[model samples]
Target: MKTIWITGASSGLGAEISKQAQSKGYRIVKLARSFSTSKMENQNIISVHMDLLDENQVMKTVKYLSEQGLAPDVVINNAGIGIFKTAWDINQQEAEQIFRVNVLGMMALTGAVIPIMKEKQSGHIIQIGSQAGKLATAKASVYAASKHAVIGYSNAIRLELKPFGIAVSTVNPGPIATPFLKQADPSGSYENSIKKWLLDPTKVAERVVRLIETPKREVNLPWWMNVAAKAHAVAPHLFESIAGPFLTKK
Candidate 1:
């Protein structure tokens, strides 16, 4: 059976993916800050403590996994943070923390797996990005910036790793009903505004599992959002003027 190592496996999309993938018969290695083996009863599940923002802990965990020699067939970089605020309102420290988890932490974990995958010459690296990465909105400036970095890094690494037979793919999902969103928009205003667009985490988890075998360069869920993103790319100022009001409000 193939082994899949996923970051942020304690909750949200990560937790769903771990449960669903394990049902599919894949050995799952779950990494999260507070994940406990005692809480998990599945024989296929292995819990590893990991804090993405802590470089030292990340390195130690990577070393331990590497020593285990159970080189995973897939590595999912799904740990991330979102801060919804206007660029001016987001303090310097808040912005930095966002980058620390969304960008730097993602890269650090990916870096740890790249060497092992390169040697194996066969593995898929999946990045969970955001629609805001492609289309800028008002209150999510820092979040958007971090996802932009993720998308860029995923695409660039795809080309770099192609020769090694390691596939890199990115999933850019629109609003999802996850704790990340709830924390980012505590007032629930943003979720209420986009309630129609919110997606099911279980559905997304299934997509990620299927994509492990059918590797695509990138996928933007909910075709309408993809269209909107493309349209925004074509005439950004126009789309901004149209969608700016709701997106900007906190």
Candidate 2:
């Protein structure tokens, strides 16, 4: 059985992925701050209490897992937070907090695990990205920035790790219906159109499983999202002309 380690396994996409992976017979290690895989948990499942924001605890946990020879065939960085706020409305502290969990924390854990995988010249790094990573939108300014960083970082890591026989991949899903949107702005300023298009977390999880099994360089759900991102990139003026007005609501 392949050993897989998944972060953010407590709820939403992460939790669904953990369960689905479990059903597939992969020995799973689920990491969450306060949740457990105890219900269906067994020796094949190890739930760890992890706070990615705490470097000391994060490093310690990695080291301990390493010492136990529990290296995984794949590590999924699915733990993240989303904040929806207009650029100016979001303060410096809030921006840092978003990056701390969504960006830096993922890096810390990846840094901890890469060496072991490198020694064996085997492993996969799966990052759960978003459509925002491909294009910037209003209100979700800071949140989109972090995800955009993830796309760039994942691409770079893929190039760097390819020669070592390690796979680096990311799944960018559009408008996922997770706690993210509900907690994003908290001011309820997000447009109604986008919210109505939210995709189920399980649907995203299913795609993730496909990514894990096949090991694609990168995958994006909802074909139209990729199309729109391209248009936004190549024809920014036009994209903004139509998209900008609706995105920024009072």
Candidate 3:
């Protein structure tokens, strides 16, 4: 059976992904600081305690997986934290934590797994990015920046790992109906504003899990969002000017 490693599997999209992947008969290694057997009632799922903020813990988790012959066939970098605030309003600590969890920690975990993948001559690394990364919006400066880094990193590694038979895929989705919004926008204003547009967590998870069988360079949810991102790339000023009111919802 192929072993799949998923971070942030304690809740939200991550949890949904785990449940769906397990149903497909894959061995799941769920990584999260708060992950517990009680929360994950599947005997086929292995819960590993991982605090991505600590590089040491990431290394240890990888080592344990290796020692136990659980080298992942696919590693999904799904763990992320976001705090929505204007660039000037976001504090230094919050900004740094966002990068640590959303970028550096993800890189550390992926870096550690690369060698194992290279040794096997095959593996897939999937990054959970955001549509905000493609087109930055007001009040989500830092959060968007972190996701932009994820996309950039994923793009580079996709080329570098191609010769080794490894694959890299990035799933960029717009606002999802999950606990993530509750934490990112504690005020609930943004959630309320984007209620109709919020992507379903289960639906997004299904799309993410599909990548394991048919890997792609990237998958942007809600086809229209992808179209907007492409349009923004071509004419940023025009897109921003026209969508200014919509962009400020966050």
Question: All candidates' TM-scores?
Answer: 0.95, 0.93, 0.97
Q: Residue 84, candidate 1: how far off, in angstroms?
A: 0.7
Model 2, 1-250: lDDT tens digits are 7788899998788999999998898988888787532233687888888888987877987887777666888999999888776788889999998899889999999888888889999999999988889977777788889999888889998998999999998988887776666677566545255666668888889888877789998788788878888888899899889977644542
Q: Please report the TM-score between candidate 3 and the true structure.
A: 0.97
Q: 1 or 2: which has the higher lDDT?
A: 1
Screening candidate 2 with a backbone cut-off below 3 angstroms (N, C-alpha, C), the clashing residue pairs are 84-184
For candidate 3, write residues 127-185 as lDDT tens digits: 99999889888999999999999999999999999999999999999999989998998
Off by over 4 Å in 3: 36-43
Q: How many steric overlaps does candidate 2 have?
A: 1
Q: lDDT value for candidate 1?
A: 0.86
Cα error of candidate 2 at position 5, Å = 1.2
- What local lDDT score does residue 238 receive in model 2, on the 0 to 100 scale? 92
Better of 2 and 3 by lDDT: 3
Global CA lDDT of candidate 2, please? 0.83
Model 3 residue 100 CA deviation (Å) reads 0.3
Question: Model 2: residues >4 Å from true position, as ranges?
Answer: 36-40, 187-192
Candidate 1 lDDT, tens digit per residue, 115-223?
Answer: 8889888899999998888877888989999999999999899999999999999999888889988889888888888888789999988888888879999888877
Cα lDDT over the full model 3:
0.93
